[model samples]
Target: MAKTTLSLLPLILCLLYISGTAASANFIKASCSATAYPAVCVQSLSVFATTIQKSPRQLAQTALSVSLARAQSTKSFVTKLTKFKGLKAREYEAIKDCLEEMGDTVDRLSKSVLELKRVGKARGPDFLWHLSNVDTWVSAAITDGNTCMDGFAGRAMDGRIKTSIRARVTNVAQVTSNALALINQFAAKY
Candidate 1:
């Protein structure tokens, strides 16, 4: 009987693991459904399912981290674009402003991530206050991305440069938007 029980242990553990995984996926899907870019949210976050494990706070933190990474990558791409020669003076100026905005976006997202880490320990009003700070910083980050894209507007900017920068910034903005939505959901439930 002991031998039989020991043999069954692996099977029981496997079943538990499978159930946990499905629950995580289902939780992510449900949380993402409330986001502005639900598909992007799910695709970007599904890999962290095991870690998130149906917790709203974990989901929000992971979303913020993903958004921060995207912002940093987009900022680097814009920085590289600035080195191109023969750009119109207007185009160069636009690139300069965009780089600054992206820098600000990265800063705001970083702060939001840090604040989110603190939300776990706070109680009562403190939790709400920390969550509010995260919400404000994330919203500011989204604004910065939009501001970067705005610099590329009109026919004065190089078509390719404008298109590429706008595309990348738009993607970051959407990711940030999803993060903000997740944060709001977390706040509501908490």
Candidate 2:
């Protein structure tokens, strides 16, 4: 019995030590998880910034496509303005002026994007702000796009045109929302 108890004592102590170690490890893991948001945000932003950096040519190509589309739409609008038979001349002029203002605003935004791209190239992965509020980041993106659309809407001379612009703006807003959600999911996981 004495020999059996001596052997059992070491086994018991070993088991107790293992359990203590495991419990401490688990506690650390839980604590890390609880405080992981900022780190996750930083990591995800880094990945996103890197992705953006990796495809500068592609981004520029996409921007070109956007510019082309906007130009085509503006041409169509100008053609329509020239042929509008029912509207008074002054009304048509007002619409044309509004469209011109909106075009200038879009041009400014495109220029800003170009500038941002240049800054991003020079700064590497430091272009994106280290933001903790995922929602706010998303909201800002949407607001920026919407502000452009709003400039168009404010200049819009007719309900039909306003509605069309609003639909397009909503689509852009949805895309921005999706991007934010994706970023947030990545932040949560890593």
The C-alpha stretches of model 2 lying farther than 4 A from their native spots are: 1-75, 124-190
Clashing pairs in 1: none
Q: Which residue window of length 10 is worst by lDDT in model 2?
A: 41-50
**Superposing every Cα of model 2 onto the true structure, what RMSD results?**
15.6
Q: What are the lDDT scores of the predictions, listed in order? A: 0.92, 0.44
Off by over 4 Å in 1: 1-8
Kindly list the per-residue Cα lDDT of model 1 for residues 1-190, writing each as its tens digit. 9999999999999999989989999999999999999999999999999999999989999999999999999999989988999988888888999999999999999999999999999999999899889988899998998888777777666599999998889889999999999999988887
Give the number of the best model, judged by lDDT: 1
35 Cα displacement, candidate 1 (Å): 0.9
| RMSD values, in order shown | 1.6, 15.6
